[model samples]
Target: MINAESSAERTVAGPLRAAWGSRAEASALADVLLPPSTALPGFADPERWPPNALTRLASVLDLARSERGTPWPQPTASQYARFFRDGDGDRTDYETPVFDLDHRLTRAVLAALVSRDDDLLDEVADGVLLLCERSTWCWPAHEEHHRLRGAVVPDPDLPYLDLGAGVVAAQLAWLDHVLGDRLDVRWPGLRARVRREVRVRVLDPFTSRHDWHWLGLDGDVHNWCPWICGNVLVAALRLVDDPADRARIVADTVRAIDRYLAALPPDGSVDEGFEYWWNGACRALEALDLLEHATGGRLTAADVPVVRETVRFPRLMHLGGPWYVNLADARALPSGGQPWHVPQEWARRVGDRDVALHAAAQRSTAIPDTAELGRALRDLATPLPDHPAEPLVGSVWLPGTQVGLARATAGSTAGPTLVIKGGHNDENHNHNDVGSVIVAIDGVPVLVDAGRPTYTKQTFSADRYDIWTMQSSWHNVPEVRGTPQGTGRDHRARDVTVEDTADRFQVRLDLAPAYRVPALRSWWRTATLHRDRQRVTIEDSWDFADHGDSRSTLHYLLAGDVVRDGPGRLVVHPVSGARATLVAWNPSLASAALTVRELDDPLLRTVWGEKLTRLELRLPDPARGSLMIMVEVCA
Candidate 1:
């Protein structure tokens, strides 16, 4: 837990101001030089303070300082060091090369100051300043070395003047030392130029692209790009004093917010995944706060409910732990990374303690001292009894609509009763395992859907896509004879059938036919909490007019240390440790393997890789038949 005294001391209402005040005059000057459109709207209003935001902010600041100071077991220096290393040509292996360590340290120092730990703040500030000076010398030369080697060194020519890095450096310098008379005399001008350059090079280009071609645009399916870009603009606007440009910036930002918010389904389902939820959601909220502060509540009437609902999306979708693995490109689960602060900050702002608690609960490792704050937020944010259930399904269902089914049984210790998905391949960060079901009996996963593999080149290439795990060959349906079960451009599950009885529950889902194949249909019948055991049976019926003599097979490949009883039956031992069971089958007598070659589709190869291995269950008979798998849970 964070020290109370430290948090109390660092109680500055607006931390950004403290960090950037030294350049106020120069910013004022730049504002005069720039056109009116460059300035953000409402730059002159008194700064708006977060109502309760400072409390958690102070706690986070104190905890970060404590963690940095204590010799708590650190990851191997190599692990920390690898982030600074050069990327191999593989797109999957690429890491953001630039490390804003000085910025990070500065933020830590500022956080410490917020916590009222002046001594610690002073110490951190000194280290950060020194690192900043040294990094300026090291990064440029290092990057040049790589550029000479024909590597895809980012912004190679502008080595010494990377915009994002410069912004962090400038903010740190201004916070630690006053400009003009206080610091080196040239510091003020240098700071202004850095701010201007960042705006011109990075901010301007990125924003202009949004206006001009919209080709390089990040899809609006989720909120990350616009929010990040807006924040950058806000920073640039803060540095300039020109009222006209400030207004333009404000208007543009508001427009972006409106467009991005439109993408959210009214029910607040963010299919893009949680990583982006935090990234985009936090930035948007911050932008709104900043806008309102500058405009003296001119934007006060903005859609507060939408903002609230947007924030709530992550909470509803949170499966367990700190991870939310939804849609494509999501890692198997959420990681306790930097974004955890978002919920905490929001909880404080809205005076809702439960949201804060939710954030704290997610940090499984090195629980922060701010758990109390989280608990408070959770309590306040708890929904009222009459609150309606937010719709979870979208309206994009095709010939076969996507369906999710689950049943929670009484006296069932099994984790999830049953969780099933019948939809097109997840497009964002998808795997080839569509029409897959992950079942957990009494909190234990029995029939499982194998999660993603690596994100590097090996998995992104064509070689992996040909594999059953990355293709339709290993799934629970029929595969076209010669052609692969290509990704569906318009894939969805429809014709849903669900029934629940006192003793059992059943759900059946139909998926769209595979690509280039005659209209094919398949469905799965799952009987949950049966008399003694659970059963999942799948049936596939296909009529291929163009393709003759095509055979279908069911595929189920087992992984880990499972004892195979026979080709038809396998019993897993209780002693062996496993988290879930992976079940996949093709009823069309298709060839199946644990791993196969990659395919040619760029998107498929990019996500699932060229070579892949997954548990496959292939049906031998395709005519008038059904495949059934029964899992008996050992309580």
Candidate 2:
């Protein structure tokens, strides 16, 4: 656990302000920050970037060049009004066009810079002008004006700076920095228009407003604090010509980031899980990197201890290729929407060799296909050091979030791995899955946490838990008295503990707090992974107000093809290259039934094919108040 006093004292913004708040510091920053054209990549000369940079980035350039004549899609008024028409709202209608414009402009800039193609300049200018002419940069789902004032369309006068807005603003800022001079020579006043549009849409709204919830001025902060602020920071530093204004904007960003840093647990675990780490923690690292560079190493990650502590989180959570411990609403197979360079660079900065190599392994030779131009540019300029791609494997215990992963082997994917979680039900993108466990054999999941489906109107609404995927019944936990676990922070695990020894690793949790069962008094679950035996055991002992708690059922969501061996045992055939696992339980105490859940959601299909199986064990007479289940790999 992090010391309370140390956490109180560790403030990123406090030290930053003390060192760089003055006009002198701002001037120093301005002097050190090279002009966009002269900065990293040096306006795309072969001497500036790595020899393989252009060739690696050619895929993106070629795609954009092929689509040069394609007109940018525009969201209709009806499409923008879909949110009010539906309860949850459709974000794709707004995001599809906005992000397409972002991608096109980013590609045009990269192509022009790399190939020095004059034809691409016109495409770049057209993309920028069209973006400026758009109704609003903010996604309909994120527009507060609609909820606050019942306005169907975005208020032109009120520019809401959201994730989309910040991204667009940064895109324009980077493009201008690199291609502004050339645009000035060919297309008069175009660069000025880009500056005007960005300042009005993102910068003015960002600095002038204190009420934006994402700023974290009043209360709780999440990924948005760092993700949005990081983008805005890039825009401010590059486009805001005045040193005083730039300093003030950067100062606000620093303080905002402090809230996010303060919220991080002692172990640097993201309760939101592995997928959001890219947007939340990685963005914070990028922000710090920018600060370090702009200040000439005056402010560094060394100032913040948590930065080093959290840098290895993604690496720690990895369970081989395309499989992560999908704890929350994150997909099992991440879309890789964000670039890998962010973590690679962060690992390099913090001297984490294992994490750096892991990040390098995920890195595509091509410039990452992301809307964030800043990320792509930095990735293009920096060459990844040669290292064998190997995932760190063994055992990891994140006490802050009460998550544990135990493997049968130290550094090889030759045996089964067991993962368990004991967090509250109200975690970010939460699933009611306290005291849930996942077992993977040879790096592929057998007993799985069935990750969430595609987002729709209800994903974030009051009816969020109504979705079956968000309920405890669909997870790998027991439903007490025919009732699943409840939602909220109060619905959480208690007395969680982890024990690690040379021969075994185990985790224990009092899971009664996670459910609201009238007859339930206590439910203690202990999951142990015996290393030499390559076996995992789950022992649940419970006492209830009523001794006959016969209604409770233990649920296990299984991936791969399942074959019933008998009433007490099931043989699981892994979907891919993983070995099969055998699940066994006490047949005298309970009876087993299998149900297939056909997955129709596009996102879920990507990870678990056409269907997954849910195995339910109904306790015939829970009067004994104890049950033991064993899962072992079948050679």
Candidate 3:
């Protein structure tokens, strides 16, 4: 635990005095504030609130409080005090040793207030307000004074203020005093400083430009960065007196929302996993909520079905629990990262129980009554009265030659369809995995995607390419000239065809158009799954043409423990100890070898276990090549 009283004393008073310049500006800005008469488009409809959902949520909160023997359902501010004090408090670093655990507790406490738990609400609100008053307003720089200093002196263009600390401060203020009256009293100077920083540093610079530009020149257009930044601007607009400035912020936010919404694939697949989804989606939803609340429902209605469908997309494609594969920088397995339910509360408010169910399922491990919620979700997910025949396609083609695809078949045992990856290495947060496929059989992962490791300096540098998850050597891909297939801007996959019959279903993917080398021309891959009641045969084929002397090697890197193996056959085991065999056809001309290597890197080894097995098949020489591998499973 942390010493809350002591920590608060050090941060609050001195910073207030230093922010006198900002306080003066804040007073000036407040004088010009004007509320918007018109609501922005794409906000949720006020008429569609879900029936009994709030009551159910209230019941859950009541149960939690009863079980925990606390007035509130969650931990106290004192219990969360240490999270704000653990690290060196560097802003740029990914590892924040100290976090305000009370933030989530406060959110839960506020959410629980829907049940009329006024006593708990008052207690939690008082603690949160006190904590906010004592602790520094923004992080990376503890106080508004430090933030203002950085904004004015060192960096005139403070880009991270929108996504990082500024948004957090705004959210905290919203929780502390819903009407913004109490915040004007106790933290008058601090609030003033924040307003000044926003107006001079952020709003002025952003309003001048209209094209798609992010804060840092990192070229990383992440989901939450713009979304949260927009929401924070909206919050700032609420307090500012200048009508022009307020209108500018609101217009900028709406435009940014349009751009952000456009990035979401038509099928509702977001490249960043559930974590990013929560951050980005919730911010967008909050903006929508705020627009409705402020303007009395004048905003245009969002496509509720589409938004709800997007929320359900992840659940339909989930491997297990919180473990979603690395579609685009997504971890294949679940870590102890925060769950998606934090934002799902907003989803429930919009009358999307299906979306709520998805969130509930992902966060079930943390919430005690999640099993019941999961069951309820399953009932809701049952086959519709008039379901469509075509298997849902959750795939998107990005500008940088990135083709990401995910599909789910009709029948339970028919299994989820092929989830394919073929693209460039230069894309945002990308790995070297070109032409990697993670297949699920009977809703269970037969071919696995090893999730991401912890991000540290060591992990990013020397150990980056070494991990099986990040390496091309660990995927089910073809090896070009005894080396992993190098990625370029032109790399992509298309001309896909699927044929389904009574006994067999085959999917053929054309990759010849993706590569540039003349020798690798006409390169195509095919996977045929033949079902015979309880057993299935998965046959793969690679066809290539026009190489006189060049040799090509096809390989499958098994990323799991080796349970057992015969003299010739390599048997790789999964977490559930399910047996899967790796069989190569042309082993005589091309040698096949299986090697079990331990994950030596500290960051990767911590998340995934120490050991993994790689199965490699090396081809000697071929003029025009063809290679094949078959995986058969039987109970």
Give all TM-scores, in the order shown.
0.61, 0.93, 0.65
* The candidate that achieves the highest TM-score relative to the unseen native structure: 2
Local accuracy of candidate 2 as per-residue lDDT tens digits, 1-635: 22122333324344335444452244545555544333323444545988888888888888889978787767778888887777657767766766777877788888888766778898888888888888788888788887789999878788888888888887887787777778898789887887888899898988777777776654567899898998888888777777667777776677777668767886889988999888898888888887776655666665466777788888788777767778898876677745777778778777788888888888777675454677778888878666575766689999888999988886666678899999898787889999999988888888888888877778888988888888899999998878889999999999988899989999999999888776778889999999979899998887787665347889999988999887789999987788888999989887788999999988888899999999998865554467788888875
Best-fitting candidate, scored by lDDT: 2
Cα RMSD to the true fold for all candidates: 11.8, 3.7, 11.5
Worst 10 residues of 2 by lDDT: 1-10
Query: Against the correct fold, how does model 3 do in TM-score?
Result: 0.65
For model 1, the stretches where C-alpha displacement exceeds 4 angstroms are: 1-108, 111-194, 211-223, 281-286, 289-297, 300-308, 321-326, 338-360, 363-415, 441-446, 457-484, 491-507, 519-550, 555-560, 565-568, 571-613
User: 2 or 3: which has the higher TM-score?
Assistant: 2
User: Over the full model, what C-alpha lDDT does candidate 3 score relative to the true structure?
Assistant: 0.45
Q: Residue 501 lDDT in model 2?
A: 91
Give the lowest summed-lDDT range of ten residues in model 3.
378-387
